[model samples]
Target: MEIPENYPKKYWHCHIEVDTGGKKNTSAIFNDLTIKELWQQVVSPWHTHRPFTVDGTIVRDYDKVQKIKITQTEHPQSYYAEQHNASMQRKGIADMATNRRLLPLSKGKDYTHEFLFADLTMNDNEQEKVVSNNKIFIVHGHDEQVKETTARFVEKLGLEAVILHEQANEGKTIIEKLEKHTDVGFSLVLLTPDDVGATVTDKENLKPRARQNVLLELGYMAGKLGRGKVCALKKGDVEIPSDLIGVLYVEIDAAGAWRLQVAKELKVAGLGVDLNNAI
Candidate 1:
């Protein structure tokens, strides 16, 4: 076969630099040949061997090296890309670690220690798993302590809570995380001044985050699934956005006594079922 100039073919070349004999030792060299040629070169000086020939070609086992030369370097992601990548990697590591121990002990031919599925599929599956695992509520409000306390209250009812605090911290942005919540069966947003003000105008001059990521998420749920799948959890003091006038909102206090009530709301929303429990 004709080898292309760009083909990355690597071959093993062996030679001996040390020798021992009755007289002074001599060095021998062999170029681009098999182990047999190397041995012959070492032994030929002494006239102690018969005819020798290399048995095989070194270029035969170079597919991996060849492929490596053709592979492109991986490019770094933008800010958003980095956020999504980190989230994906984190979830992958978590799922792999958790499922690693549960994997079958049998040495079956089909069993594998590492899974090589698509990252998108794994992430989407993780989101679905999260939604079905427990009742989840997305709380957004002006007062950090108040909104957080409400989420904590929801957690007290044995539910999942994700409090999108108004303060933009060093963590992942709201839009980055919301895209991964595909199977988010139910969500609740606490619309406040900070949440609305943080939104930026897009090229279309539309306020994407006007209601915060919670609002974008709600819009996604409404458009994809329907309006019944999401709720608005707001304190009585804040004015509700005009767009969310008809949506349901669960009002909670800072004392964390409303946990059971939030759990009841989640049950009413039909997101209290655990779908991943069987697997």
Candidate 2:
């Protein structure tokens, strides 16, 4: 069935995402009508009735005449994939809400959340002085002292740092948490002996080491921002993984020399570091 024009339908578009491994993993579209039709087609065979989720973001608007710019992104991590889909749905609804002006949708029956699309290309007349800021996410192991020392080191450097102690939960899986938070300005992975042995097995019962998760997180980010964005910090002389041979890292030593070394390296890489805070 053709979607009604006045009933809040938007332009349609599709794209494919590729990973650093050059694999085309997933494809998606940005039309409200097409998505609903597809959902019907999937359920019509089974005769079970329920709304479908490609992810959490749902397609509500469906327009056929309008054309949207389609950009294909390859090899995006889970974090990026969710963001990209949400952005498209928001944009589609925003067009209907504001007569083509890039504005938040009005709160009403047709739309749920208001979406604000800032024109990134349009330069603002007023610009504020930029302060160089860096946020480092610390993925810690079971070692409390190591976590605290790392936090203290980050505190010394004047950079905003938060040590994430991830415990397995039924709601938010460890993998999801890592993927969700790994895309910060920088990530500090404290690799412990226990962490190296940690592994999540698949249906086939094949188990990989736990350190593999950290590598996957780094691999996902490196695919987007390149190699320098991620760093592996050695807690106590753990052997580097074969996959991480190309990644640059610092070794932790007595008196916390590794912290100082990392701070220096970050600054050299154009990441602003507060030397006074590094005390």
Query: Which has the greatest TM-score?
Result: 2
Per-residue lDDT tens digits of candidate 1, residues 1-279? 111234222221222223233354333322333323332332221121111222221111111111110011122113334544577688875333322211111111220111111122223444444444354546463457656765665565556665444334556665555544433445666654453232254444423232455566666655533455566655545555577566766665565344445455566555553322211
Query: How high is the CA lDDT of each candidate model?
Result: 0.40, 0.46
- True-structure RMSD, every candidate: 26.8, 16.1
Index of the highest-lDDT prediction: 2
User: Cα RMSD for candidate 1?
Assistant: 26.8
The 10 consecutive residues of candidate 2 with the worst lDDT sum are 122-131
Model 1, position 205: C-alpha lDDT score: 40
> What is the per-residue lDDT of model 2 for residues 98-194, given as tens digits with 9 covering 90 to 100?
2221111111122211111222221121111012126567765566687778877776676767444443454776667655444345667776555
lDDT of 2: 0.46
